[model samples]
Target: MPYKAGHPCFESGCAKIIPHGQKYCDEHKKMHPEEIRNSSTRGYSSRWRRESKIFLKAHPLCAICEKNGRYTKATVVDHIKPHRGDQELFWDRDNWQALCKPCHDRKTWTEDKCPVYHY
Candidate 1:
């Protein structure tokens, strides 16, 4: 069987083919240099860890999985909107949602086509 086609580069109008596991093709990946950064440098630091722990405690079930009638434990606190470098949006609790790892990855793959860069 022939291999299935891969996804287009996440960069807008970029026709470069890339694997599902990657966000961008080699050329465009340079434009998204922050993608290679460590989690702590991307605002997932000690403060975020502490706050996300509290968030998960308050909302122990994945919102999407719960909506679909499965009771998955929420381990990730996702920003409903990509906060990018916006400090205000990053800290907005109203823009947050509780999600399991699978649910969070699915949402990111489908919805967050643009990667969020922490400045």
Candidate 2:
């Protein structure tokens, strides 16, 4: 379906109409880079995965949910603080939390001011 004439592009200051089912216009889409990176390249390497598996095994329930008296199974090993690409912080097990998908997504959205799109 074609976009309505007045629908603005998602990119800031661009007045172009967004195509149906797309967040951005053709121009903005081309300008934007890939939103997410592969786990291996984004520092979630094989080692990280292995460690995360071990951590998750030990912490099978979501920490936040557990604190709230809920028992949700954990699927993500998240850093308590923003790592900001810092190697030390990224690998710090003490600063980690076991989170279910919803809990992790909510926390990340709060921290980053953006939604976690799993494309």
Candidate 3:
């Protein structure tokens, strides 16, 4: 099949066309090297996925929802304390809580101090 030109670089105001199969132009890609690295390194790893699956299997209900008298099924294993990319903290089962997606999102927003929407 003939190669189709990709969309413009994701970086605002960058008109450079990205090569097929690439998300960013060469210049923007270079400008955000840390983002590329963090994308690969940060968040849940394979081990985390395995462990979280086991955890959720054992604890199938949202901890926060339980406290509020709700019975939501847990879908995420959240760290009680912010792991901040620390492997030890990330893997600490004692620091984990099984949370439903809404509870996890609410907890994260509260912990991150994200601005509340008035609507």
Candidate 4:
């Protein structure tokens, strides 16, 4: 017989009932816990790191340091708006700034304890 939309079970011999419009019974199509969980937990892969590295290499001097007359090498990217929950600011290149090691360290320390990044 053809599959029925309103049928409770796929077939009389099936032990478990199937949902309307489904071809297979529950036991036949049920997904494992690991399969379902792993699919959702997938994260960003290596491509993102490669792009960021390329950007840093092309512009190697700290923007802040360069502007302030210090020529420290920029090794880290700083997000004007942090990537905690503000998703809109994630890839905003205009909001990115390069910082030297000591300056970056001081900025992070100030951010952890103070209200703003000081020059």
Candidate 5:
């Protein structure tokens, strides 16, 4: 019997048919060279990077500086809760704050230093 749409042509397959271009289904179509490489990686994809650039452009001024009445340009997205061991917290959008390069570096350096060992 001929395979129908949403029916797999081969055994152990589960994909719908695409009449035009590639015959592979939606999921299979996404497995193409560019899409395969793009889907294989995780976190902060190129699209995310582009979105960040757009965000910086939209809100050029630092959100913190604005709150403090400083009006400085934003340059970094900082995590409120530092991700020491858990990488998941590293990209928590809700836990992020926008800071200028200077402020972000200062905060990061401060966190890196051993307060107990330093005078």
Candidate 6:
């Protein structure tokens, strides 16, 4: 059989080869434990869905759109400040706002800077 292919280590400037279906090799994994946990464990759950639905009902209009006078309907409950797996902040109503998917995506891309781009 041919040899299995692998990718370079995710660590910046590291050339260590690691198997596929992983974000980092064993060596660099320790430095990024935060990336190990899946999204549900990070805070989102069934309860979050229910609460977000209720929140959307109560705040039907998108906060960002309302500010811009567009009156678009809200389809997502966005945390004004990132909770970053903090349960208290995750459940904090004061830190939540209703947003359309587009505005939420834009805010997340601009503010959170997740999936940091290479170029």
> Number of the top candidate by TM-score?
6
TM-score of 1: 0.70
Question: Per-candidate TM vs. native?
Answer: 0.70, 0.67, 0.63, 0.50, 0.47, 0.76
Clashing pairs in 3: none
Supply the TM-score for candidate 6. 0.76
Cα lDDT tens digits, model 1, 1-119, are 87767998888899888876788888887788767566777688899989999999999999999999999999999999988767788889999999999999999999887666555
lDDT of each: 0.87, 0.80, 0.80, 0.60, 0.60, 0.87
Model 4, C-alpha of 106: deviation from truth (Å): 1.2
lDDT by residue (12-62, candidate 2, tens digit) is: 898887655566777767554344344566588889989999999999999
In model 2, which regions exceed 4 Å deviation?
1-10, 15-37, 114-119
Q: Write the per-residue lDDT of candidate 4 for residues 1-119, one digit (tens) a residue.
A: 88655545444476565557565555644432222233223322365456557768878999878988889888877776544324456566776777777877787677633223222
For 69-88, candidate 6 gives per-residue lDDT tens digits of 89999999999988776788
Ten residues in sequence with the least summed lDDT for candidate 5: 31-40
Local error of candidate 2 at 7, Å?
Answer: 11
List candidate 5 segments past 4 Å from native.
1-48, 114-119
Residue 4 of model 6 has an lDDT of: 70
lDDT of 3 by residue, 15-116 (tens): 898777776787778755434564338657787788899999999999999999999999999889876566777788999999999989999888944322
Question: Measured by TM-score, how close is model 5 to the native structure?
Answer: 0.47
Candidate 4 versus the native: TM-score?
0.50
Candidate 5 lDDT, 5-53, residue by residue in tens = 4534221265454554344555665444332233215345676577567
